[model samples]
Target: MAGQIPIIPFGPHATCTLELCPIEYSIFRYRPSLAANITFVVLNVIFALTHLVLGLRLKNWWFSGAMVAGCVSNIIGYAARVFLWQNPFSFIGFLLQIIFVGSAPVYYTAAIYVTMTRTVENLDVSLSRIKPKLYYVIFIVCDTGALVLQAIGGAVSTVSSGANAAGVNLALSGLIFQVATMLAFVGLLIDYLIRYFRDRPVASVATRLKLFLASLSLAILLILARCAYRVAELSEGYNGVLFHDELLFIGLEGVLIALAVVALGIGHPGLVFKDGQANLTKAYSPVSVPGGAESGVELVGK
Candidate 1:
């Protein structure tokens, strides 16, 4: 009995522990790095608190709420990873990480979509090919679908103990769908920017506006990259080489998403848009020009 492999339950609710099973029985094939997962947990907590404070101070409810939710999901997911570090064969921990971490970015993308709508309206609604509100409706709907798919897939995979190919395929499809949606959103954003710049060229762009746009763009690109990596990792299923590579997972999943979260904070729309909204109100007031015409609202550059 000393050399015999222990037979243990293998579903999401498995009762197996390291004492009963060999490390090879774990899906990860190695213990999760406690230091790395703990770092991620701490980072997510800091970002969540920061967003909560900023949201309350600025009354930016929607953006702040979405960011806080995403960060909380990351915290839970990484905490699950920490659980795995302690007990490498924990199926529940694996389930929690896969479901929460995989779906967390959907909230971030929703936040970005709403911001884009506001950005288009604040800058030049007429320049956008579609109505500004459509951006919110379209992207958010797609993001929600991706989140649902991922959650369901994770559940299915856990119940099957990674044996059901359909579950892995479902998760992969969700990630791929998310990547496609982001690409489309980025395409539309670029188109709108080109049209706006061509129609209304400014002599000097405001530093605040530049920083906001740059940070937002950086976050978008990073999230897109992370999603793409997830798609690749899931394509090979749980037993694949890429699935077992912790270094790649840490870099692409943990580090990239953390940077994206920081970018979102840097580009907090409340800071940039608050003044612009006030200026917009004043511009739209029934003020008269010297030429006996109504004053037109110009885009806020500062």
Candidate 2:
């Protein structure tokens, strides 16, 4: 026992430094990539700045705020990863990444939810089953719930140093809830589009609207995919195979979300909505009744 190296416990309370403990003892079981994380940080900063400028210029407050917040969360999360690259056993770094990175996409989803209302209102509000405003209200509320779950789970995991099953389960529930919410949102969007095009042929669809819809759809799908991946990764808890797969994390979590952020920028409502307010008069003008009375009703009233 005199010549043997002393084994150190790995956790927040662990006195193990990188010099003392093996990297395998770290929560991730591997060192986080410095270059990859730094790249994510840079990408998020650029997109965040872009959204900030555009949001300010067009006064798209909600969209801008959500995007900026999401990007900032990403920045902080990846920065934490950078710290982990230096010290894989760092409790603070692990906690930051778990909490911030895990919940960042909720903000992106929140932005999309708000944008959907405007998109439906601009295209044809009557085609949607629910009021355009309800899209944000319902989905944003769900997103908030998911965020709260994930945040609490992350906190518990940190406190337990990644050994708590309940904490992992709570986070997994959040991801699953988020994925389900996104699926429902996509279903409603597709339903609206189907009804819109069926009633008023696709040839009449504006090019701008088409691009916005395409970008929006792409963003939704990407984020949904990422959320699904996260759910799978968290399913096995901290020591799961997918959880330790750096390549999977990079592709699924990092690349997928980065592309989604880009898609959101391309499909920003300010550029498509033309001043960001629905032309209610145009969308729902007065209709002439048989008795010669002008009734204020939507053209395609539900």
Q: Best by lDDT, which number?
A: 2
Which pairs of residues clash in candidate 1, taking residues 3 or more apart in a chain or in different chains? none
Clashing pairs in 2: none
Indicate the TM-score of model 1. Answer: 0.88
* Model 1: lDDT of residue 256: 97
Report residue 161 deviation for candidate 2 (angstroms).
Answer: 2.7
Instruction: In angstroms, give how far residue 276 of model 1 lies from its true place.
Output: 9.5
Report the C-alpha displacement of residue 32, candidate 1, in angstroms: 0.9
The lDDT of each candidate is 0.82, 0.83
Alpha-carbon error at 178 in model 2, in Å?
Answer: 1.2
Each model's Cα RMSD:
4.2, 5.1
For 3-81, candidate 2 gives per-residue lDDT tens digits of 8755554556766678888888888889999999999999999999999999988778889899999999999999999
